[model samples]
Target: MTVPTEEVAGAGAPEPSAQPWWRSAVVYAVYPTSFADGNGDRIGDLRGLRERLDYIAGLGADAIWLCPWNPSPMADGGYDVSDYCDINPMLGTLEEARALIEDVHAHGMRLIVDLVANHTSNEHPWFRAALAAPVGSPERERYLFRDGRGAHGELPPNAWISAFGDSGWTRVTEPDGTPGQWYFHTFAPEQPDLDWSREQVRADFDAIMRFWFDLGVDGLRVDAAPAMAKEPGLPDYDLTSYGDPTVFRSSVWVDSPQWDTPGIHEIMRRFRSVAREYGEDRMFVAEAVVSSSQRLADYVRPDELNTAFNFQFLKEPWGPGLRDVIDETLRLHAEVGAPPTWCLSSHDEIRLATRLGRTDTTAVHLVDPATAPTDLELASIFHRSGEWVSLASLPGSWA
Candidate 1:
């Protein structure tokens, strides 16, 4: 996994002025569960991550961005956070997390943790109270809880679809054992969306930021950054452009009532101010998937996030289309005075080699190993092996 120092330095050289370390630093995204299993329970923990600091440092990475390690129900792979201030016992303890942070700094590498502010696990205390409280109570106001439509309240509040291919609204059973109000879940029902409109929600996240920063964390990667804000009215989407069976279909409409609204920018501005309070070196990166490059740039405005994931590059084919995206991304990011962050693959997406070796690159769908055709020639050419290897082996070996 060692990267050539010359290449790393050239690719991540900061400008000759006072600039944040994140502006020009190679960051490795670590999905903790599978990164390294230190406890021998077959689950990666803080000890495992600490043990791998040398390995990551050897790879010439300037920082490591860890996926959510907070206490969670594991319903959405730890993205359904139950506690923002504590470490998941299954992963490790809060002391171990602090030790890992110090250990990472000892190796001269920064640590950026995933901040899942958009949602919380249904099992979270806030969500639990929301469920127990009567509809329209303050506890319910912390989350997006709305009464269902139609007679007998049998229908979802709106036709918004979850990212996981189901209705975004999940009905809860009242204390009397009857169907109650529906709660919004942008991703999975187990992860209910938090109402960012609540002042307490904003203040709570600000405190979370301070807690992590005070713990020696270098930065935060905001999860579901764009969906944090919704339009004033919970409006039904016009599914005409989304095509039939639009449950999991990608929405091209950036102005949708549920996605990329102006309120998100204000939230980002607040987050940016919080990060600055710790130090100018502390940073925030947005995981926003918007319609256009300009829309992506909006997340990294001078007063907003430090940078955003350039997802267009990951979806583009290796041809003129890729070049066009890169050119546009550079131009758009420059216009906003932010560097373009490129990623070929991610934990949520298919492996880069697999995507590049596929015959139909434009499909943009998750690869189903059971039904996908193996491009033996392409795989051999790209990976230099006839046998398919795991993502861990492919990149390390190729490098």
Candidate 2:
């Protein structure tokens, strides 16, 4: 998930480059954990990814964005990282990561890894140590922790709920022997949020990026980036009291403190600087869920992400009228004042084929290509085909 603060050289401080490939590229998203298994362990690994490279290329994609493959406890589907540099043992080894990179390049395709910077798993060493320290200790400061006062005499610093389920804050007093404090986790209790307000936390995250970049990754797909900065006042939220706001997409606190906070842009600038340093054409893609065009524009400033994922297309209701999604995309592009990219599917949601009812094979019909019986030979064959046909003038089939 994440690491603690430590002065790391060659991190955010990087030189700028002229251009990067992501500016005009189409990337295919792949969830490696569910793609295919190579070792027969029912878990996808680097070798499996290698096997599927040709298939991905056949789609006319310029690159592929892989979901998290970092060493983890499988708490949140490998989004929880135990080590920044090592590959998860169940997935594969570091050697496999290197080989995958080489193979991807050989096929003339780029690769992007999903970076979950907002939090780390509770089992992470840094979080473990932070949980044990006193309330005001520096280690505890790396995470969001404060003493509780009411409702069991101890509660989290805020009431913001997690994306998965339950309260975002969890009591970390089991191992530590003292009146415990609550730590903030935006997704799951196992994933504790990092204090980006602290300079050390920012620098620590930058170092993690450098580690992967040096390993030859083309770029990153920033996961949950808008949720990086929590509101400082620890204001009580009305939505958190009733139900999880994530599924309905109703609450503003799901992300964005107010809308277009300068802090979020600064964090992205630091990451963009890293891409420039390598002089490698890298794409910085943001996974933002802001509904309005203006809110979406804030994340994709020319100074920030080159391509931000567009969800307006995926949020449409199915019917004969499909222009609403197209109209929304054009409106968002014009109103938001930024270039946008669209995705038809992601691992977190349902497949479009199933959602659109296009998977019903029983409804498909063949069509006849002949018109006015110009050729009796072809017409006789078509008459004898005995197949379901929708139209009589189509190119391939007849009935």
Candidate 3:
């Protein structure tokens, strides 16, 4: 697809100084365990993060966005949070988190915590309570549930595929003798999806954010927001080639209503409203992945997230043809009118160095998609994308 560069030329006017520093600041994404090790425990903790604050600050990042350090089963690498209120025992404690935040602030940098509101760890008390509560009970309503035996119940809520290539739903059994029921999880079987349609669920999340916002968090990085809302009827799809269940447990709802759900926007607006109440400016960076640029732009409008990561670069082939992709990248953001957040690499991606041709130039030269090796082109695409894009963790002056 050809992306025009008109939008890049008109992306934004100069920002006023009074605006939040994060809005214009570069960020460094830190995976705690890999960033540094404190106490020589071989795991990254808040204390380790504190000790490395200078390294991060030296990178010239305006802030450090910590991946979920909350207590978790680590089934999906800490995304499955068991306690939003406490730091992971593997990472540190509440006291350490406080110190990390203080240390980050002292370095003239802010902290953006990852809030995976879409789901939580199976070990979480909420999920355990949800398992025991009756279908109509307040606790049960916190999670997505369907009768396991009914015709509609036999299938999951929808056919939406999980990001991880598996059925998002899992059967829940009770300690007492009882029929098993399906619980929705868009990503992993162990990460139960929240029933955002339920009022109590929304309230619980609001309170969860408040618990942290009140603790002085600067912002939040929302994970998989587009999948937050599921279809009400919970439709199913034809089986996949492997004969796996067509319906992913997490989403009973798919494009039936619209690609982007109204409920998702409502929830984001509520989050933003609450963020405004706090003294710090709460910036929302949406991690939305979609095929069409129009669909991606929909997530970053004035009312939704402040910015969304552009995946065009991630999908492009490296070479001179990359100019079109880079141009398109800037153009797409310009059209959205939201400041673009360029991403060459994230946790989910293979390192850029590995993608490029393993040569001295590191695949910097562009190649023709029709003739060049796919890997070489991809490497070049990522290399060029990084040249001008701002990342949460990488140095801004790269390339």
| Best-fitting candidate, scored by lDDT | 1
lDDT of 3 by residue, 1-399 (tens): 222223211112112134656556777788887888887888877777898888878766786778888999899989998988888898888877877777777787777888898898999999888887877777877888766645645665555556566566677665576556788777788888888888887788889887776666777888878777765666654545334444332222324322246567788777766665553355677766654566676777776667666665554656676677667656766776666665655676545556554443322212223332335554555456454354343322111
Deviation of model 3 at 205, angstroms = 1.7
Scored by TM-score, the top model is 1
Stretches of candidate 2 exceeding 4 Å from the true structure: 1-20, 174-176, 240-262, 319-328, 331-338, 358-399
User: What's the CA RMSD for each of the models?
Assistant: 6.7, 11.1, 8.4
Give the TM-scores of the predictions, in the order they appear.
0.87, 0.78, 0.80
Model 1 alpha-carbon miss at residue 218, Å = 0.7
Tell me which residue pairs clash in candidate 2.
Answer: 1-81
lDDT of 1 at 60: 69
Q: Among all windows of ten consecutive residues in candidate 3, which has the lowest summed lDDT?
A: 7-16
**Clash total of candidate 2:** 1
Summed backbone clashes in each candidate are 0, 1, 18
* Model 1 residue 38 CA deviation in Å: 1.1
lDDT of 2 at 216: 70
Model 1 Cα lDDT, one tens digit per residue, 1-399: 333333222212222225667777777889998899889999888889898899988876777889999998799889999999999898899889888877887777778899999999999999999889997799999999999999989899999888887689999999889999999998999999999999999999999998887777888999989899998878876867656645554325655888888899999999998877755677888888777888899999999999887777666655667789878988888888888886656787766667656655443333334444346565555564333223223211111
* RMSD after Cα superposition, model 1: 6.7
